[model samples]
Target: MRVTIDEDKCCGYAACLSVAEKVFDLAADNIAAVLVEHPQGELADQAREAAAACPTSAIILLDDTE
Candidate 1:
């Protein structure tokens, strides 16, 4: 999966960080950022949850596991 975050849509809710700190983090601008381009195993699961937890829907998951 390809995790992408739209900083503009981020509200600094830190939901992503709470769920997937290893995959997502706050940038210098205080917006959500994808730390890992693609996560696997449990990290992947958390990433998806993080994306869903985003109030602004800043997180976008692009599945490339075909």
Candidate 2:
């Protein structure tokens, strides 16, 4: 899967980091960033959870099939 974050919509909540540290992290600007654009297996599941945990819905997840 492909993971991305809408920087404009991120509020620096760090929720994504909490859910998927390997896939997401806070940038110097405190916005959520995709550390691993493409994740697999457990990481992919974590990415999905991170997207759901995002209060602002800033995380965007695109399946490879798409």
Candidate 3:
């Protein structure tokens, strides 16, 4: 799965980063920055958790599997 953040929608809650530190980071503006485009192994589930944890619905998860 691929994970991304909509900077405009981000409220800087840092929930995503908290859930998946290896997959996301907070920038200077407190917006979520994607550290990994496609999460593999256990990181994939972490990525999904991060997406679900976002209060502002800023995290976008794109499932590559069909």
Candidate 4:
């Protein structure tokens, strides 16, 4: 799966970072960004959780087939 964050929608709440620090990081602009293009196994689960946890729903997970 591919993880992405909509900068315009992100509020820098850092919930995603708290949920999956390995896959999400706060960029210079203080918004969350993807640390990996494709996360595998447990990391993938964490990424999904992070996306769901995002208050603004900024984090998005695009399935490989999508």
Candidate 5:
């Protein structure tokens, strides 16, 4: 899976980081950043969980087909 973050929608809540530290992290500006663009296995699942945990829905997930 592919992961991204909408900077405009991010509130620096860090919920994504909390859910998946290996896949997500806070940037220098405190916004959520994708640590791994293409995560697999357990990391993929964590990325999905992080996306759902995002209160502002800033996290974006895409399938490989796209």
Candidate 6:
């Protein structure tokens, strides 16, 4: 699965980090960033949870093609 983050929508709440720090990082501006473009195995599930946990809905998950 591929993950993308909307920097403008991220509030730096660190929800994503809580779910998967390996796949997401909280920048100095507090916005969540994609540490890995494509996550697999357990990391994929964590990434999904992180996206769902985002209050701002900044994290977006796309299929392999996307």
Q: How close to the true structure is residue 24 of candidate 4, measured as C-alpha lDDT? A: 91
| Candidate 2 residue-wise lDDT, 1-66, digit = tens | 888888889999998888899998798999987889999999999999999999999999987777
Give the alpha-carbon lDDT of every model. Answer: 0.88, 0.90, 0.87, 0.89, 0.91, 0.89
Report, for all candidates in order, the number of backbone clashes.
0, 0, 0, 0, 0, 1
Q: Which of 1 and 6 is the better model by lDDT?
A: 6
Question: For candidate 5, which ten residues in a row score worst on lDDT?
Answer: 16-25
Which portions of model 4 miss their true places by more than 4 Å? none
Worst 10 residues of 6 by lDDT: 25-34
lDDT of 5 by residue, 1-66 (tens): 789899999999988888899998898998888889999999999999988889999999998788
User: Higher TM-score: candidate 5 or 6?
Assistant: 5
Taking the tens digit of each residue's C-alpha lDDT, what string does model 1 give over 4-43? Answer: 8877799888989988899988988888878898899999
Candidate 3 overall lDDT versus native: 0.87
lDDT of 6 by residue, 1-66 (tens): 899988888888898998899999877787777999899999999999998899999999999987
Top TM-score model: 5
Judged by lDDT, which candidate is best? 5
Candidate ranking (TM-score, best to worst): 5, 4, 2, 6, 1, 3
TM-score of each: 0.90, 0.93, 0.89, 0.93, 0.94, 0.92
Put down candidate 3 lDDT per residue, 1-66, tens digits, no spaces: 777788889999898888899999988988888988998988998988888888989988877762
Q: How well does candidate 5 score on lDDT at residue 2?
A: 87
Using alpha carbons, what is the TM-score of model 1?
0.90
